[model samples]
Target: MKKILLACSAGMSTSLLVAKMKEAAEKRGTEVEIWAVAQDKAPSEMKKADVLLIGPQMRFMKKKFAVVAEEVGIPLDVIDPVAYGRIDGEAVLNKAIELIGE
Candidate 1:
Protein backbone atom coordinates (compact mmCIF):
# COMPACT_ATOMS: atom_id res chain seq x y z
CA MET A 1 0.00 0.00 0.00
CA LYS A 2 1.17 3.48 -0.78
CA LYS A 3 1.42 5.87 2.16
CA ILE A 4 0.33 9.46 1.64
CA LEU A 5 1.01 11.98 4.39
CA LEU A 6 -0.53 15.43 4.51
CA ALA A 7 0.88 18.18 6.72
CA CYS A 8 -0.90 21.28 7.88
CA SER A 9 -0.71 23.90 10.63
CA ALA A 10 -2.22 21.72 13.35
CA GLY A 11 -3.18 18.61 11.37
CA MET A 12 -6.82 19.03 12.38
CA SER A 13 -7.85 20.90 9.26
CA THR A 14 -6.73 18.11 6.99
CA SER A 15 -8.55 15.34 8.84
CA LEU A 16 -11.60 15.68 6.63
CA LEU A 17 -9.43 15.72 3.55
CA VAL A 18 -7.74 12.54 4.70
CA ALA A 19 -11.09 10.91 5.19
CA LYS A 20 -12.18 12.02 1.77
CA MET A 21 -8.99 10.73 0.23
CA LYS A 22 -9.55 7.37 1.89
CA GLU A 23 -13.04 7.29 0.49
CA ALA A 24 -11.70 8.07 -2.94
CA ALA A 25 -9.11 5.35 -2.59
CA GLU A 26 -11.81 2.91 -1.60
CA LYS A 27 -13.89 3.85 -4.62
CA ARG A 28 -10.93 3.29 -6.91
CA GLY A 29 -10.06 0.04 -5.16
CA THR A 30 -6.61 1.36 -4.51
CA GLU A 31 -4.73 0.21 -1.46
CA VAL A 32 -3.41 3.32 0.23
CA GLU A 33 -2.61 4.67 3.69
CA ILE A 34 -3.53 8.31 4.06
CA TRP A 35 -3.10 10.50 7.12
CA ALA A 36 -2.43 14.01 8.35
CA VAL A 37 0.06 15.46 10.80
CA ALA A 38 1.03 18.81 12.18
CA GLN A 39 3.87 20.50 10.32
CA ASP A 40 6.12 19.97 13.31
CA LYS A 41 5.54 16.25 13.06
CA ALA A 42 5.91 16.00 9.32
CA PRO A 43 9.63 15.22 9.07
CA SER A 44 9.33 12.15 11.23
CA GLU A 45 6.09 11.09 9.56
CA MET A 46 7.53 11.60 6.11
CA LYS A 47 10.04 8.89 6.87
CA LYS A 48 7.16 6.42 6.82
CA ALA A 49 5.27 7.85 3.88
CA ASP A 50 5.56 7.26 0.16
CA VAL A 51 4.59 10.86 -0.52
CA LEU A 52 4.18 14.11 1.42
CA LEU A 53 1.50 16.67 0.54
CA ILE A 54 1.48 20.01 2.30
CA GLY A 55 -1.75 21.86 2.97
CA PRO A 56 -2.12 25.04 0.96
CA GLN A 57 -1.81 27.05 4.14
CA MET A 58 1.54 25.46 4.79
CA ARG A 59 2.87 25.85 1.26
CA PHE A 60 5.74 27.99 2.44
CA MET A 61 7.14 25.05 4.35
CA LYS A 62 7.67 23.07 1.18
CA LYS A 63 11.21 24.34 0.86
CA LYS A 64 11.98 23.21 4.39
CA PHE A 65 10.44 19.79 3.75
CA ALA A 66 12.05 19.31 0.35
CA VAL A 67 15.39 18.52 1.93
CA VAL A 68 14.00 15.77 4.12
CA ALA A 69 11.77 14.46 1.33
CA GLU A 70 14.76 14.24 -0.97
CA GLU A 71 16.73 12.43 1.69
CA VAL A 72 13.80 10.06 2.15
CA GLY A 73 13.41 9.79 -1.61
CA ILE A 74 9.72 10.61 -1.84
CA PRO A 75 7.71 13.02 -3.94
CA LEU A 76 6.52 16.18 -2.17
CA ASP A 77 4.15 18.88 -3.23
CA VAL A 78 1.61 21.35 -1.87
CA ILE A 79 -2.04 20.43 -2.18
CA ASP A 80 -3.69 22.44 -4.92
CA PRO A 81 -5.51 25.36 -3.28
CA VAL A 82 -8.60 25.02 -5.44
CA ALA A 83 -9.00 21.30 -4.86
CA TYR A 84 -8.14 21.63 -1.19
CA GLY A 85 -10.66 24.37 -0.61
CA ARG A 86 -13.36 22.16 -2.15
CA ILE A 87 -12.13 19.05 -0.33
CA ASP A 88 -11.98 17.24 -3.63
CA GLY A 89 -10.71 13.89 -2.47
CA GLU A 90 -10.66 12.23 -5.85
CA ALA A 91 -8.49 14.93 -7.29
CA VAL A 92 -6.09 14.81 -4.37
CA LEU A 93 -5.98 11.04 -4.49
CA ASN A 94 -5.30 11.13 -8.22
CA LYS A 95 -2.47 13.57 -7.62
CA ALA A 96 -0.96 11.32 -4.97
CA ILE A 97 -1.23 8.22 -7.19
CA GLU A 98 0.35 10.11 -10.04
CA LEU A 99 3.17 11.23 -7.78
CA ILE A 100 3.70 7.66 -6.66
CA GLY A 101 3.82 6.63 -10.33
CA GLU A 102 1.10 4.09 -9.76
Candidate 2:
Protein backbone atom coordinates (compact mmCIF):
# COMPACT_ATOMS: atom_id res chain seq x y z
CA MET A 1 0.00 0.00 0.00
CA LYS A 2 1.18 3.50 -0.78
CA LYS A 3 1.50 5.96 2.09
CA ILE A 4 0.42 9.55 1.49
CA LEU A 5 1.26 12.17 4.08
CA LEU A 6 -0.34 15.59 4.32
CA ALA A 7 0.99 18.50 6.32
CA CYS A 8 -0.78 21.67 7.29
CA SER A 9 -0.22 24.53 9.71
CA ALA A 10 -1.92 22.39 12.26
CA GLY A 11 -2.77 18.71 11.84
CA MET A 12 -6.47 19.17 12.53
CA SER A 13 -7.28 21.00 9.32
CA THR A 14 -6.28 18.09 7.13
CA SER A 15 -8.21 15.47 9.04
CA LEU A 16 -11.28 16.04 6.93
CA LEU A 17 -9.24 15.90 3.78
CA VAL A 18 -7.64 12.66 4.94
CA ALA A 19 -11.06 11.16 5.53
CA LYS A 20 -12.21 12.28 2.11
CA MET A 21 -9.09 10.86 0.50
CA LYS A 22 -9.72 7.56 2.25
CA GLU A 23 -13.27 7.52 0.95
CA ALA A 24 -12.00 8.20 -2.54
CA ALA A 25 -9.46 5.39 -2.20
CA GLU A 26 -12.18 3.03 -1.06
CA LYS A 27 -14.41 3.91 -3.98
CA ARG A 28 -11.59 3.12 -6.40
CA GLY A 29 -10.65 -0.09 -4.51
CA THR A 30 -7.25 1.30 -3.86
CA GLU A 31 -5.32 0.43 -0.74
CA VAL A 32 -3.44 3.35 0.67
CA GLU A 33 -2.39 4.73 4.03
CA ILE A 34 -3.17 8.43 4.32
CA TRP A 35 -2.59 10.68 7.26
CA ALA A 36 -1.99 14.28 8.29
CA VAL A 37 0.41 16.02 10.64
CA ALA A 38 1.48 19.49 11.64
CA GLN A 39 4.24 20.99 9.55
CA ASP A 40 6.75 20.39 12.32
CA LYS A 41 6.05 16.66 12.29
CA ALA A 42 6.37 16.30 8.54
CA PRO A 43 10.03 15.42 8.31
CA SER A 44 9.73 12.43 10.61
CA GLU A 45 6.46 11.39 8.98
CA MET A 46 7.92 11.62 5.51
CA LYS A 47 10.35 8.87 6.33
CA LYS A 48 7.53 6.36 6.04
CA ALA A 49 5.53 8.03 3.31
CA ASP A 50 5.50 7.39 -0.39
CA VAL A 51 4.51 10.97 -1.03
CA LEU A 52 4.11 14.20 0.90
CA LEU A 53 1.44 16.78 0.08
CA ILE A 54 1.50 20.14 1.81
CA GLY A 55 -1.74 21.97 2.50
CA PRO A 56 -2.21 25.14 0.47
CA GLN A 57 -1.98 27.26 3.56
CA MET A 58 1.47 25.83 4.14
CA ARG A 59 2.66 26.08 0.55
CA PHE A 60 5.55 28.23 1.59
CA MET A 61 7.08 25.27 3.37
CA LYS A 62 7.41 23.19 0.22
CA LYS A 63 10.88 24.40 -0.56
CA LYS A 64 12.03 23.59 2.96
CA PHE A 65 10.47 20.16 2.73
CA ALA A 66 11.94 19.43 -0.67
CA VAL A 67 15.34 18.61 0.73
CA VAL A 68 14.01 16.15 3.26
CA ALA A 69 11.68 14.61 0.68
CA GLU A 70 14.62 14.17 -1.67
CA GLU A 71 16.62 12.50 1.05
CA VAL A 72 13.67 10.22 1.71
CA GLY A 73 13.28 9.65 -2.01
CA ILE A 74 9.62 10.57 -2.25
CA PRO A 75 7.68 12.96 -4.39
CA LEU A 76 6.52 16.17 -2.67
CA ASP A 77 4.24 18.95 -3.79
CA VAL A 78 1.81 21.53 -2.52
CA ILE A 79 -1.82 20.54 -2.73
CA ASP A 80 -3.53 22.52 -5.43
CA PRO A 81 -5.27 25.45 -3.74
CA VAL A 82 -8.40 25.16 -5.88
CA ALA A 83 -8.86 21.46 -5.28
CA TYR A 84 -7.97 21.79 -1.61
CA GLY A 85 -10.45 24.57 -1.06
CA ARG A 86 -13.10 22.47 -2.75
CA ILE A 87 -12.06 19.44 -0.69
CA ASP A 88 -11.90 17.38 -3.87
CA GLY A 89 -10.63 14.11 -2.46
CA GLU A 90 -10.49 12.20 -5.70
CA ALA A 91 -8.35 14.87 -7.28
CA VAL A 92 -5.93 14.72 -4.39
CA LEU A 93 -5.89 10.96 -4.37
CA ASN A 94 -5.26 10.90 -8.10
CA LYS A 95 -2.41 13.32 -7.62
CA ALA A 96 -0.89 11.09 -4.95
CA ILE A 97 -1.21 8.01 -7.10
CA GLU A 98 0.33 9.81 -10.03
CA LEU A 99 3.22 10.86 -7.84
CA ILE A 100 3.73 7.35 -6.59
CA GLY A 101 3.37 5.99 -10.14
CA GLU A 102 1.15 3.24 -8.86
Winner by lDDT: 1
Predicted candidate 2 versus true structure: per-residue lDDT over 2-36, tens digit per residue:
89999999899889889999999999899999999
Please state every model's RMSD to the true fold in angstroms.
0.5, 0.6
Q: Which pairs clash (backbone N, Cα, C closer than 3 Å) in model 2?
A: none
For each candidate, how many residue pairs have backbone atoms clashing (under 3 Å)?
0, 0
> Per-residue alpha-carbon lDDT of model 1 for 1-102, expressed as tens digits?
999999999999999999999999998899999999999999999999999999999989999999999999999999999999999999999999899888
User: For residue 89, what is the lDDT in candidate 1?
Assistant: 95
Q: Tell how far residue 30 is off in model 1, in angstroms.
A: 0.4
TM-score, every prediction: 0.98, 0.98
